[model samples]
Target: MPALSPLCLACAAALSVPGAAWAQAAPVTLKEVVVSGSRSERALDEVPASVDVLTGEDLDGAQVQDIRDLARELPNVSVKRAAQRFSGVSPGGTGRDGNAGFNVRGLEGNRVLLTVDGIRVPRELTSGVFGSASFGRDYYDLGLISRVEILRGASSALYGSDGLAGMVAMSTTEPAELLKAGQTFGGRVGLKLDSENDSRGVGLTLAGRPSDTLQWLGSVQVGRSSELDNQGTNTALNSTRTAPNPQKDEDVSVLGKLVFTPGGGQKHTITLEHVDKSSEVEAYTGRTTSATSGSVLDLDGTTDMRRSRLSWDGRFRIDSAWADELRATVGVQDSDSREVTHEQRTVSPTQRSRDVTYSEQLWQGVLQAEKTRALGGDWSQKLVYGADVTVSHMDNLVTGTGAPSYERYPLKRFPETRETTTALFVQSEFATDRWSVIPALRYDRFELKPRNDGLYPLDAASLSDSAFSPKLGVIFRPASNWSLFGNLAAGFRAPSPLQLNNYFENPFGNYRTIPNPDLKPETSQTLELGTRGSTHGFQWEAAVFNGRYKDFIEELVAVGGSMFTPADPLTYQAVNRGRVRLHGFELKGHYALGKATNLRVAFGQTQGKDTVTDRPLNSVNPAKLVVGLDHRLGDWKLGAALTHVAKKSTSDIDTSGTPNQFATPAYTTLDLSASWQVTPSTRLSAALRNVTDRKYWEWTNVRGIAAHSPVLDAYTAPGRSLALALVTEF
Candidate 1:
């Protein structure tokens, strides 16, 4: 990819002024919309935080198919596929099990919380109980999403648990004024082809609203992608080689949603949704030595997810002097995952063996109510109270030709685990003519219970804890076009079930992980300051933040011999560490050259260090920069963007007999796209990703590969791929 030329920088600077025009058209104006901030419609400038809104039109113009693709265009965000050597899990949990995780300002995984219509989705996990390759199975189908709102920075004080990093809220289509007038339908069909992987796939989506008070959206997609063959797979670690020419894989997904609203004086709404995904692939382990041929493995997996929600919202006027608006929401989610694998030996056909089949079910429920009141004096208060409960059951069934054919290993069913949390939060906004002060507080109590179903011997059955978090912020409007803000907040995360109950093997030898029943919750205190403003054709935002973490939870290696009747060789455990400090900055802005052209740029950097070790934290993120140019003509729109990722240094570890720590090299990529209005109600578009076919490792997967690994030879990022689609509405 070509570097940003000095001329481009000069152009950007010159275009930053109000009323500047680069072509024969008027400057573009910022649209006024409220869903980006508060639940109620309010101007974007009224919100005191780092927020970005991507409109439905923007998504269509970009040909965005998944959340990962959508993250690339957002400010201070990065998304990458998971490492191949790391076990087969879906990349960045697609908002499920939390495996395929997304990194923002260096924070990844559960640190960042994702929500659909205010409902939290579970993260996906690996068979070993680690965060799944991606968060959840593709629960986020772009076809059903009408808009997306991203709020960056710590928000745990307002949202419980998983909001420590930030929050991503996706809003699905509903039957509002935009669709209530008449029956409307729309759909898109597209195909993509890649050069390096020789991969090909197609996708389709359809949605419609038939009545004023009802809307329904449904989508189904299936695609086949060729295995990524990188030369770097020829490495050996502890005599265990990586995979080469890994078997290709297939993915299928289905999503449906129904939304209903009553047109009575009393306001009420309900939504029901379901999502499913499945994948199958053959696995290949790269050759250990030059003389040995690789092994071929077979694997099959399926994930089924179901969610139902019923909510009611209404307002009551107690005397005309004051009024109160109330909202109550309740939801349930059922998720199940199953996987099976078969390994084939290279030397003897009969030497084949199979590992145990793994399966688990997750059930969750949430009830919440929020009330807003008008308190006369330009002062209003909002109170929110909620309770959440989740139950999970895990079963490990040993099945295969190797198992005793007659007396199969008894199904090992771990005790069912249950988690319950209740929280009370309040936020008040008091404003004068030119300034606003917002103060918020949240109190949360969490309880966990583990039931032993005769699967494994465990003594402790339950644990509980509580926390109080607070936030204070102020926003000042120095001028009508400018605003300045600052905030101080506290965040926390309770231990997840897997973190407290998982027992797995280590790479060293026959090892086991003992659960730590006595673990403290992780907490962080953060301070942030920022400014935003818009003038005619120019809009800009910048923020700086610092945070301190306490009782940080991390996986620790136990030195002593395993403690078991059989006395296993090695052991590992989860422990609470001392403290960590992190700080970062984010800057994003856009300038309209004219009605026909515009330019936008965003950049972010974060640094985290352990107070005790005085070293950078593991997987700390690197700096990132994205620049784009958009142009429009008669019924046509075009865009080109360049993204740069900085190098990252791994955390320091002294015990490593051979330290595998190093810094990832920086790289850049380019993307181009175009969209055409075929008719008043029809549109067509195309996009080219990795335009230069440049190879680079996303920071998240760098450690899984070898040193000096060729970018293309590692996990390739859809090299030089092209996609085209058509959409029509009536």
Candidate 2:
């Protein structure tokens, strides 16, 4: 090596410090690697943002039912599904269950961006007159994932819109070609059962390399889960009746992928992937009477949902200065949901039936280039840039069935809508010895066009919006085992088509939604500070973030002003609101107690308020803590965990309107897990959740309704559930 420059020498000196090794120095494996946040493949300590990487081992030990289940051990994270407590979407438990969406640091819905294998997941949720649809309705089958990386805070600089809170990305499993030597063909089969809802699932995975230039992986899973009921104390005659009952869900999914590589001066790898999934849900609330049998309410509705995806990825690596690697991807996704219901009264043989269909289709393409170069002696840098385009289309149509005497719903709640998005992003990483810096920028443009079928007030709608997000992060390693980090990032979300131009009317409900074309994108600026260290058989990370949101887009109750008011029906128009402040802190750590035992703790707290109104924001999460211990004995591992959540006052639940939605009391539950490796290729795992069968409610799971209603039990937490998992590979 030649003489290094002064800056290079300084960098070398900083890196030379001897510190306790994190997971970074370990031999890199396809299945086990602690990652830096996305945009690069760096170690955790090398990244400035708050990043958490869960290994396959960590995921399996958690007995995760899905990706959402992993939130128990992570700070400031939760999941959301449909709730029946409120009319459409509310807090508490929605009697309905759909694809579980992510909520990070108190922000849920389309605010959190989700991706798989670096590809953006499509937004499936749309808005309609009756009920708005959700954006992400497809779940990442856990069985196919090898690693998951969670980046907390604004990530729009790297992922574009929908990353207002953070980004979650998972890497799929590799083919058998990357497996240990001498394994020509291998597969894993598993069976799991949950006591809470008598849920059961079977998973099968197969990977193989039949030739030197080809390798492949395939997975299949099927699951069924019943309703999770409360202590049954709410069924008393005096309790306020809840409309729809708990729902039963059955789901099935299949995934397949193939990879091929060829030799030469330039190596190229091509991959093809596809996935199909469907869920059938039965609304089993059954016929029930509230306080008294004053109204005849018949309940028998089944919802059928189907989603599919197909993708192609190509990569080329060559020895060059302009670019070291070029990667490209093309993918498509389609999702459809249908629900049918009928209610009849014998008094006059009056019948009401309706068929509802909500569907979305999307196509996208991405191209990226990566380059690495030495910057004078010890300093080096990696530059990554990418461009992507996406087109999304949605359809929401409804029709009446049965007798004409019954009232009929609107034929079109939400009109045929299309959104086209184009974006260019770039990120640079410069590192020397003890100092690492990253700056990223992304520019996004959205073109939205919604069709008018002669049903709404407008003939057609055309809108365009653009945003620029920027982020800068720095990491300083003062000593071998400790590092200080900080990040300033900007994020934004464009208004959904429904919010921009939706016209829905429900004569019976006395409410209507009028579009607001003047709406602006929701934007945020966040500043974060944190420190992470690992030494003396212990590791810890702590970070605090403060953010301000501008142009907050929300559905506000409109009384008048160029919109339908008391004359028509109460109007809930999507409009931009005043500024809001969001802040939160998180702490996590683990200590190795001897070589066979480990103890860990995770705590998180968040607060959000409207700066203009000085009132609490409904999007905040209650403070929570999770403590756990694990012991490993050769091939057997035993662990226990306790989750405690603080109670919330009326302010905690976004009392912008509803108070009961935020009504949650303090509660604690214990969980235990045991896993055994019977043989080199076989493993068995078991978990006892809510060992006390405690009755509690999570503010994030259900929509808000009055607290004293009988529906409370429907949204209550599951009690005394035992889950067991058995997997064998050969």
Candidate 3:
């Protein structure tokens, strides 16, 4: 673990200036103000890490549409739900394989790293073994998010390589951000309803300034969905459905922004976005015939997505004197994923279809410089430097036909590729009074090239890698409410060009998929300890974390027998699995039982394994608790929430051999909410989720099937729901 140069990070940011003064220690005011974990702007406890923010009134009091409803309000997070897709089955990495999205602490599908507004969000790698790709293409539009920044641990120094399990930034909605100053032009309208997926939605917002150097904001959202019924208990596609199983989803979103300041104010911004989504399902082939195969299969699926982004930002307050905020960014993004499959059989009948599409096009750039001096008496120092770059291009295509057909068709399920990533970062903060210290560094480089034309069987290569991550943190505030913290970090992940050269073929299980141009890259090292406090009205936070992983890159299979079937096909490899051990504990609290009442609590626990087959490592998330209560009265506001889950007998599908290893009981759920203003611009809200219609399954939505298979595990999370909303503003 030695690698940190750039003149030792500019001589450690010039020895943090100095530190020998007194008087001038009064600062620590935060109710919020954070910017994606230290990319700038901080106040949320002076950002040392471990962050979670969701505003816009907490996404309108948790009516938040996706991101797995924030694993019931944070703690090791989760959001993996994408079921129903079978050929030889297994798309269980949750829908459209954005490649395992947002799993954070326990390690997300793509090891977490998603962003919008600050760019970076393009990852989906798969060579189809039925499906698996993750990293949030979760179809944005949390009502054009106004804020969402969640950073847990191990953030590759400062975002690089899937962030090694950390990062989820999403921002939109600005226009004098909660203006003041005789606001000019404004608008808002919203309507929503959901009764277990009979969904319907509409939203729009606009903001304006028109002068004083301009400002603008715009947003639009639309949604429709039907079919989300389950809890018929007997599980497995709701106990072999026969009818009433067609599903549908449609969505649309758009957002725009513009800002400028002109004066010594120095600022500029421009942003634009778009989102379109589609989802479909219809297939209850709960299987019942196939005795020597008399035929009785049926399946249907769809996942269509389109996303776009454009950005430009500039901020400067530098008239020289060593800089004090000079930031710049340029961006472009595009993502598209389309997967459709259909199969039908009725009794010795057959008809089939398949079409796969994946696309990504991205470009990004960033530059930053920040400075704050004054090192004598009353110590002070703040420095941040940055440089970032990303370039991407990926394409995959596969088409189909049936005798139960799929013998093949130009199958280049991810051959063409080009990737590039670059980064350089530095952070330093040294305060005085209460004491504070933070040191950070980052350096990254990644490149992959493969422009397969000969339809690849081999021969099309190039790879490059580099990484250096470091972080050290400390904060102590002996009194005045209190805080104590500690941290140590390093993270990494790389090796995806479809896992180092993917090649797959199955003219009917002859076996194939071997390409590991010596893959290696997956590392993490973490240590964290924390405490936070506030008096009287109460507020608290507690943390303990540990993580160490290396090499990690599982997936090994080579025919010759070990048959997990491809109809007699099996040949996959991508090794390098050595160490891994994660540990966790977290607690959160809040209390204000006086002026309007309030109380809340959160708890978490997780454990990991894989010290060479001692198994267990699916990010482990079990043992959780949440409790909340709220009341306001005056304008009406009320709330209640309870969540508890525990019981997961180790994973990798029950001890390394993953594939729906059954048994994952332990549940408790209840939620309720209310809000009303009903005048002064109007407002209304409601939410009710799983108020005891319990029957749950959340162990990262277990996935791996085929044991007595007839629909099998994971995908039973959504039973009992209701939500409503209405809003108007002028």
Candidate 4:
């Protein structure tokens, strides 16, 4: 990694001046905005909860490549990489896998739902019934992203079930003002060169307006990365082992959007997007001990994924006595992933093969209307009503020739499942001269069904179930610069198809799992209070939250044998569990030091516990902190950031009463970047990550090797790397 240039350092110092602080003041007037969480457009100050908006400019200035990198700049948001061998766990090349998951206020999985143009993406499946799979943190080509909006805290009141954690809405690019004015079509072409990773990539984006009432935008991006190498000699701490040569990947995506308006009415837009990615890599398996020799197993695999989406949105005004605005949206998404695995010993001569495939389709429709009227003197009221429906179907298949000969069953089979949900919600906001109040509520009904295709006749696999969840919240503004908000929301998650119909019975006795049709839905209630305000040169936000979970569904490990034979067999099945609780706090703020400089800091911590056993919940995140400084002068901009992650233990545990714990030591990393405007229409930027090149493990995971052996080490996240690119628009 390279150090910050001398000129950039001087700019940083100048921006730290006291006079620069005044720039932090909030504007006195409010602007109308359409946020995804609301049914219709409204004033930002009138929203009931904390919301953060990151414009495209912010993304460009920060050199953000994907959602994971963007998370580092937000308050109370943390992204952690998982152990090496776990890389292939995630279905798509987007990078969510076992190593990548985002924690907001310390809750992850289905809790934090992600959406693009209001379409929901499916959650990943894990051993626990909790929504642990995170698709947001993974790599999605950012060349088409125009802006990102984050709504923090429980939002079941607006988004329903998956909103137990929070929500992230990603908005894609639209025709720019220049293009709409017919001055010229605007576009950018750029290439990135990385030093440590020995990788190079390029991308292009273009936008234009065809006529006064119609606009169009399109983006295409493709990138290929070379194999990544670790930095340390100790393979255990290295980002990659075996001379650092296995991790490599490639990605390509194209997005197009069209906007239309009937000369001065409301706006209507439609979008079509497609993303395809494929990658192959070899990852380390922790050291293993054998009767003959100690060696690691090389886990080699290939993965491919394709995703497409179509959506339409319209905003119109209705001249009615009660209603003033109406907004409607309809969307559909299709995704597919296929994975192939080949395992071999690094030192010996043997090979094994396995394959798995997953396919999903989702359709959704939404309609919302809001009306604003004068309630009384110095008071105004806005009422919103909306309804939404979603249907999703998934198919999963697993096969391999690796199963022991005695257990050689059908080579392949498919398990199918489906889920549907419908919801209706309403919210009201009232404002006075110096104060404002908002109250909102929603009701949701969800249904799930699964059927067995006779793959396993003995596993009675047919079930249907449904659940209803409700939510409430309020916000108050006591002063022009201060706001207080609190919310109490309930969330529900129905049992998935895999938990109800999929079953495997092995008479040969190696491993087995039986579906439980009687599984119940998991439910949770959350309470939160927060405040945001600005002072002199500083702006800040602080929040505290707590949640209680009931009927949590968890996978339990059971040991058994074939009914006709005596053999040890490991089995896992879903089971209803006792209660669980989580509590956390978050703080983030920015201070304007002087004319050209600014400082930002954020911190978060969370603790989770199981009521039944009085034990800590697995995968709970440790405390984390991030600090950064930015400076801009004339045609140059420079920035630096440092992130610190506290030490935490892995979740893998054995029966010896002694836990198989691995401590992930705390580490701080420094990053520096600068952008130089070569011309008014062109710019060049370069950035370096992990400047210190310090070796550290990201997170822990289970290894297939013997416990306590050296061969059991998995790969760590990437080490030091540098990237540079150029952009031009006309």
Candidate 5:
């Protein structure tokens, strides 16, 4: 209805070309049903928080294979993946730990909750000193996913711990999604290729309904790839080289589901899933310096990761006064990761090796009930209550050969530990003609128990903590097309076993890490205000939030101790800091030009600081702006997106670690995508990224690198690449 930005004007001009094919007229709308916001199906406009949804069609059209690629479409969301430059003795580098995790707002790692089908994913291994191994949390196959919902803000009132920042909920494909009316059997097969990583993959999915009450679905994916490409020019070996390391990777994933409806309003579904991935890397940069004697000849590393899950979900429609419907879910998941390093030495013509492994087995159950009733004329209320329990057993082992005399092999940094959490939550919403109010609360208790196997420390510590989270939201609608909302929410995170009982003693280095039994859980409070509306084929939302955190945990903080003392080495322990504040704002909207064309824009900026130290938080991402245009004609669709990222200034970076932190420069990139419906059941899509081939580095990928690093190009993003996919239904 009104004038737009220059980019939108350009897009409008392109859509008004003289000789353009015309397609059917369909009015554009933004009315999607979402469940993550309130644990019940509701229109996206009704949700008070900031939520984003991606459907299967969106994933297919974008050719997004990993979390890093998925971040490009969302504002204030990023995933970190560093180059592979780590070797023996330095195992926790970002290069070795790929796809670290999701960062929402300004918090990352365990602060963000990731789940699939209401089942929680395992946390990453984050032992700083005791265990030098870092394992990532990307363990899902994109081919099996049908929908993804990202809720940005505090979510502890509905979920519980580990919801300090936000939550990511993914739902797998079901048999009904693939089957048509009266069709008994249906499925699809897809093939994918990407030049950025030199990877090729294939996926096959099939669903069948043998009986009126029985249905089954099965899917499998397999892939192989080499190291990701970069703009580096040097190909020589050593730390000075800028080229990517030599690496090989393989991945396999399988999923199976069976749905049964015996009678009445009862439905049950059983699921089984497994994923395995492995990689081998040649770390030429880890070689000894040229001036050193008895220098290393060669270094190589191998890593393997695996996860398995079994789950059962049931829903019943019980028409009773107390409850209108009930749902129950029970699941078990196990994850394991192992890393090995081999070092070749020339002094004695000997070889050294290190092997480390970490595993977690979890069992969880949930029961929930929903009720809806009318209070008076034009007034109604809905209530949802749930209870959940989770138990996890985590263990780690380390063994090495040809180690230093002072250091021994087969040692455990922390004892085997078990973690348990029990929670109960209730949420209610009351609505009138022009206003709606929502209130929710949750109570949780967590405990950590450790069992000593007589490896490292005789007396380990156990931690027990409890917390309560509360949330309130209000919405006011003055007209049918516009609404304003405000929300106040609380969140918390329990300390992990590794952070409570990590113990290590290095005699030669005269340093040790001791456990902190009195560690406190992290907590936060968030206030958000926003308004969203749609009119004249245009939809938009603008929101700003301020979050305050307390008892922030810092790992491996140096305490008072002298390394010269033999009996008491320099002690490092996990400690809690004072206050932290994070504030940000986001603006996003999409406008439909006509029946076949649309233009969109999204922008986000965040700022955070440690109030106690008065230093800027390094976890906050730089400001970003993205604009896109899409058009469809007949059976073909074409789209283009432009992204601009602001520079990370030196004043914002914390220079405590590296005084000369490398600040990322401002950069802009453009991408083009097109899809063709070749046949009735076949579709082909391709994406060309970084059309300008401008070399640049992403702030998330190069946070800790020094300003004077010789191999800066290794941290650069892929210059130019292409991704292609083909899907066919049977």
Candidate 6:
């Protein structure tokens, strides 16, 4: 089938001004503003892309404490959660790594960009001897976030890199957001409890305006939790155990911001943030007796992560006509992850220990400007230009006392590498009453400079690359209540430092990973068409998108040699693969059933395949349909949500692992929630999740698990659970 030529012609026609009356027709007003879609505040419907915004109230009502919880509320978004079966010698990707980042439109990991307050978040890391260490990208505290915006589809035209699939932007709360009119000081305290994880949490936020020009805000959140519950019932101490391993978790997050407005058309904000999370696990599955010949007795492990960031941001209303506003931001961030494992065996060595640590330090700066101009005949245009520069240093170390002949202690998996990226972008929007055109372009240059010390691998080398991203969007409003939009965008992701220089060799095992300095960046192009309308208290949106990705970086592809050749270890290198095609559609709407009641519905489905091999992509999520109903009377609100998921068929899976993978069955779940305003400044919310206690597994979580494993039940999601929260403002 050919592309939509009519839409293409219409977009081409949009370049020339249409003879439509501007003041006669009024577009539908949603009254909701968003910034991530276009890097400027605009009506939600005005953005020519698929975007979802979750406000603080939405987060509080849903009890979204982490990224895993947040995924339940969005369509075409998923987070992979493996079982707690990781060991010191094996930190498999399918094992206990917590929430392993997000998958949007079948693309995940470092392909998606995540940011907070315009500052980039650190990428996920998983590299060491035999992949024994891993770090995820869940360093956010929902309590301090005022809003989160998700932009679906390619976004590299604006963000430069790490936006090949999508972007998640978060904005923290401001002092004025919590303060009432004329109030000098205000704050909120919150307490939450959830049965799914047996977790307890507390959050405190304070804001004060000492003077007219100065305002400050501070927030702190703390949580303590145990292992998450699953449908598994077995409590055995060996590998047959179906229940979650005994675990303890603790986390703390702190944020501070100061805003100053000296009345010279300028405002400046200083921000300080810190987050720390730690977890300990007792690997009962690794415990065994000497008679079993398991060669192991006990195993205990702990993982610790910490991140700190400081930044200054300035916004100014420039006097020049061409540049109406100017914005500048500079920041420094540091993140560290450490994993320690101890094993006591019944074998000759008796005891073994492994300690691994990874760290990343970054400095970044951004400058941006925006302007709006009026053309003749009621036509108008807005221009946005920006520059971004970032420099980062990363290093990883592994030390162990497991005196295996082939294993050595105190070694570097990847040498210290300095990464730098510089980019410039410009976007323009031209609009009239009936039509609008948006075009954007960005250029980025990235360089990786490795410190070639003694730890550096002789075969590894530095790398430099560049990319150009561009996008075009067109919107045609045929009626006052309707909008038809089309967009074509390009995105790219540069290869990671570790992927280009990682060096690992196990002579005894006769397998090793070689560096690939010639690896190219992954690139993608997406075409989307959609329509949105509002009428009679009903708002709806439907979109269809097709994307093609090329030069996918496949890590650890067998390049030469054989595993049986001890003298010639099997060589595996990162290489670029063929093309991938993914297409999907989403439908969402909200309807006002009555003066006090509302109904919501959303459905999404995606299909992906390797164009060369004609094989289905396992990262693609199955179809999902969600329905919700809400009613409010006075200060009490009641809501119910029903979710139905399609089953994963055998054909959709790529079961080539040592243990064949299983297919998930279809399932449906219902949730009920209620919120009551007990007092003028106090509120309470409660939710009953998985009301039916149905047993089901998320495809992303069990993608690689053994089909016939006795612990299959361990991969099932939490059965019936309850969450409660209380908040008070003063």
- The prediction achieving the highest TM-score against the true structure is 6
**lDDT assessment of candidate 4:** 0.63
Candidate 2, residues 1-730, lDDT tens digits: the string is: 1233332233334323243222112111122244426465667777788888876677782388775576776888887544433221111223333545778887777888888766666554544333322334455667667778888998887788889989888777777533557666788888888776677888888888787777778788888876554544444222244322455677777768777777552333333344444333333343334423323245345566676777787777754555676878887787777655554433343455556677778888888887766655565666678998988897776665552332344466557889898998877777777887777777788888887675455544577888877777888989989999999888888887767766655555566677677788898889999999999999999999999888888664574533334456676777787688889899999999989999999999999988888887776768999999999999999999999999887755565466545387899999999999999888999999888889887877654556766556666666787888888887
**Model 6 ranges off by over 4 Å:** 1-32, 91-93, 127-130, 289-294
Which portions of model 2 show Cα errors greater than 4 Å? Answer: 1-36, 81-93, 97-99, 124-128, 131-138, 234-247, 264-294, 346-349, 402-410, 454-457, 506-511, 559-571, 659-662
Ranking by lDDT: 5, 6, 3, 2, 4, 1
Residue-level lDDT tens digits of model 5 in 1-730: 1123332233234222243232222212224588888877788777789998988667883369887877886889999888888767544445677887899998999999899899998887766552345788888888888898999898888899999999989888899988888989999999999999998999999999999999999999999999989999988787676788889999999999999998778999999989898999898877765736667778888989998999999999886765777999999999999988888877653688888888999999999997776655665666778998999998888888876566677877778899999998888776775777777777788999999777766478899888777777788999999899888888889888778877777787688888889998899889899999999999999999999999999988888677888777798888887588999999999999999999999999999999999998999999999999999988999999999999999999988877889999999999999999999899999999999998999998888899898888889999889999999998
Give Cα-based local distance difference scores for all models. 0.58, 0.70, 0.71, 0.63, 0.84, 0.84
In candidate 1, residue 171 scores what lDDT?
72
TM-score of 2: 0.88
Residues forming the 10-long window of minimal summed lDDT in candidate 3: 22-31
Model 1 lDDT at residue 531: 95
**Candidate numbers, best TM-score first, in rank order:** 6, 5, 2, 4, 1, 3
Query: What tens digits encode model 3's per-residue C-alpha lDDT throughout 163-227?
Result: 77688888888877646579888878888888776888888888889898988888889989865
- Residue-wise C-alpha lDDT for candidate 6, range 50-82, written one tens digit per residue: 988888668873467677877785789888777
- Regions of candidate 5 where Cα sits further than 4 Å from its true position: 1-32, 90-92, 130-132, 289-291
True-structure RMSD, every candidate: 10.1, 6.8, 23.2, 10.5, 9.7, 4.0
lDDT of 2 at 677: 93
TM for every model, in the order presented, reads 0.81, 0.88, 0.34, 0.84, 0.94, 0.95
Cα error, residue 406 of model 6, in Å, equals 1.5
For TM-score, candidate 2 versus 5, the one ahead is: 5
TM-score, predicted candidate 5 vs. hidden true structure: 0.94
